[model samples]
Target: MKILIKMKSSLKDIVELIIQEFKTIASSYSILLVLIGGIFIYGLLYNYMYQPNVIRNAPVVVVDKSNSKLSREYTRLIDAAPQVEVYGTAVDFIAAKELMKENKVAGIIYIPKDFDTRVNRGEESIFITYAVTQAFLYYSSIQEASAGAMLELDDRYRPNMVVFLPAKDVLQIAAATPISVSGTPLYNYTEGYGTYLIPAVIMIIIFQTLMMVISMISGKERESGSIRHFAEQGTTLKRVSRIIISKTFVYCILYSIFGLFLAGLIPIIFQLPNIGNSYEIIMLFIPYLLATCFFGLAGSVFFTDSEAPILMIAFFSVGLVFLSGISYPLELMPWYWQATHFIIPAAPGTLAFVKVNSMGASMADIQTEYITLWIQCAVYFILACLAYQYNIKKAIK
Candidate 1:
């Protein structure tokens, strides 16, 4: 009778608690920081990382009118830069243009009949060329890499083209003469702003929604003494466990489907090519999605008023997104920042997306991350179970 009276007294406070917690969550730092950071990342990505370093697979046809060893060396040097590939060696200008018209080659390099003579005489010689404007930035990088390789080869062969190349240009000297680079830029081979940024945004949605929904229910159940009734009624440990587990499973399935559609399927529908195997991407994320749901559920069990869980989630969401390299790549960040990123879930999550969508990677590629996610999931499930069984009773009393 006393317990029933106490319950009636507390019913109004429960409604107030839900409204207050919701209000507090709405104004939390995680929400604010995520919004601000999202804008910052978009601005930074366009202004910085999207700047092309080199074309991935541009076709370059060589016209050796000189038929000299020097022209041959130049051809070889240009072909090795990780961007340019030898389309065809043309006998003359007309043949090269034929290849270009066929779209078999992107650019043509014309070596005049006395190419070596001009260089040996220390005469300024223009290596005439044909490169149409196609994604000017990518073309420019290919041009620069080609030109840089030519000058470098000139130094090695001329042995005097640059007084400082061998001594002053430390990186040039240290790198192997034929040091190579290539871009197997897999998913979103186009690598446009939307293709890259949108996947990360999807991940943000997944992490946020799963944590929010799970926390809302778990926290509400705790403060309302529902957990105590379940415990006191001896609602059977198996059933109590099933309740949270079922909810967690539902959240996981819902967000995983939502994210997969947003990140994986939509890009393909929009014509973003080379977006890896859809099945592989969906399969890989199962463990990660599982980990996040339980991690948030565990947090809910520990938090009484919901304010702390909400705040913690908000902090982690923004912090994790930044650390994940969704906005800016970890490759460009300072060494210390790169080192710190690996510990965060966002790092692994972002990498997984890049691999599945961009790289055409299989299970072998993400084995380490898959194992990590499962291990973390196990840890969270254990903690959640322990908390509900032992800690909730104390908190309620």
Candidate 2:
């Protein structure tokens, strides 16, 4: 009977708390919420906003002074680079520089008049281009295209054979060949950076948005004597856990459908490949969503001021996103940093998302990743529980 009364009272407090939070939020106009929500969602979608990595059709101006077949071939090779959309060739250096300065093109390549003569005479040549850091990706792709052009020449002109030196001294024939390389870029396959970026950003947005909403509301209740009333009377860890579970359930459905619709429907409509399992993506998200919610809850339960949740949530947003491999690749990171990346829930989440969606990785291939996600989820849940207590109510008051 006593336990039942405790449960009933806790339920009442929860209802009151939710209603109070709703009132506070509702004070903002609907248009404001819509605007805020749009900004919030957009932020979640475009973490590296204002300028994203949509490098396709990037502008490149070619200054072809050579007019010869070889230079034309080189110009064609530059045109073929998917990262750059070739603009009309510049008549002179002044025009090329003007185009670059006006932001009409990201870069310009100057193909000197001696281009073919130099190649035919077995002489080295130079190509000059300019790029700002923002245009670095396009610049990188151009360099790769230049390499491919070199390889094209080498393959067409050079032949391998055993050069016999007049007698028994069968020395390998050497032209003192100049070393050359070709670096062809494999594009993002999905045709846009958003495909890769959106997947990870969606997860990040969820973590940040929910962290802000839940923590502020949770913290406010604590500071306003509500947590004390609930704490001194009726509260259980199980009830608190249930509330979190319910909210996550709601948001998970909302976001999962929203994310998948964009990821799936948009790609299919545009003939782009989503190539990922909805089930696996959802499963992968389980650990991350749970971790984020409880992480906020733990902070709210511990902090004396309402602002702590906001600060802590923001700090977490930056750190966690940086570590998630959404911005930087895991393979490129230092070995120890890779290990650090693995420890976070987002690492496994994003990896699994990309594997299942982008790479079409089989479940068997990602079994270890699946297991790791569950382990991390459990670890985070344990930490949140251990760090959080029902008595947080009395201490703040």
Candidate 3:
């Protein structure tokens, strides 16, 4: 009977603590900004900025020194390509450089005077292309369009080289090649910068904001000495466990709504890839949220003031994104970074979400990441309990 009464008291304490956390978050303006404005506003702004997805008709200046029918035809073909438009012709390389300096074009294409001569003689012909270093997409677009134009030019001229042969043999010679190469971009059909990046960014935003909020709340409790009130409730292991549970429960419920808006609605509004089974994405998200929440709770012990978390945790935003392996592949990373992937929730969570959501991978495909997240959850949850126990002890002193 006495044990049952203690159990009832602990349950009541957990409920009260949960309600207190809600009231505290509602009352704190900084917490409100990080919770609502940080996630919703930032998510919308990022998607809006990248909404264009693919760059098209990027302008390039051509230096056509050959001034022949063949060179003119090549120039026309380059302009017709969807990736780039020929803004104008420059008489020489020097003139093209001036246009590039003026930012009049994203790239320059240089066709040498021997361009037509080499083609006519059935010799290898090469043209130079220069793209500004401002953006890789500019260079990629220019390169793709130029290479495509060159292939078309090759087909048009190959028959001319075999003019003396019999018609059937000539046709075969023009068509024959050592090998054929075709490239098809999977998942991201357009190969847009936005499509490739935004999905991962969304997951990072969730991890970061949740971490900041938890740290701030923890810091506030310590700084204001409100932790004493919590400590006074009880210093038993059971009480500390209940306190951690209550805090985690409050954060999870709050972020579940936020997660829906972020993972669900934002992708639809921005037309980002959302092909993953919704249920599986949620299942993946569960461990990720728990891992991040408990990870935040554990780390909050280090924060001495509410403002400290904002200052310190904010610096990690870029680092966390890099660690997620979206910006770079995990296989090529050094052994230590690969190992670090296991410790950080965002890393596996981001990769798994990308595979499931963007690549349409099944739960089976993400088993490694799914398992890693649960491991982090288990590890961090224990750490959070220990951290709160320390805080409660300090408050009692």
Best by lDDT: 3
lDDT of 1 at 375: 76
lDDT order of candidates, top first: 3, 1, 2
lDDT-best of 2 and 3 = 3
By TM-score, how accurate is candidate 1? 0.49
Pairwise lDDT winner, candidates 1 and 2: 1
Please, what are the lDDT tens digits per residue for candidate 1 over residues 292-384? 767776676566754456566656656666777766776898888777665445567666766666667787897866676677778877766
Compute the lDDT for candidate 1.
0.63
lDDT of 3 by residue, 36-138 (tens): 7889898887787677677699899999989999989999999999999999999889999999999999899999999999988878888989988666567
lDDT of each: 0.63, 0.61, 0.89
TM-score of each: 0.49, 0.63, 0.76
Better model by TM-score, 1 or 2? Answer: 2
Q: Which run of 10 residues does model 3 get worst, by summed lDDT?
A: 157-166
Clashing pairs in 3: none
After superposition, candidate 3 runs with Cα above 4 Å error: 58-78, 87-180
Clashing pairs in 2: 276-357
By TM-score, the candidates rank as: 3, 2, 1
Best of the candidates, TM-score: 3
lDDT of 3 at 209: 91
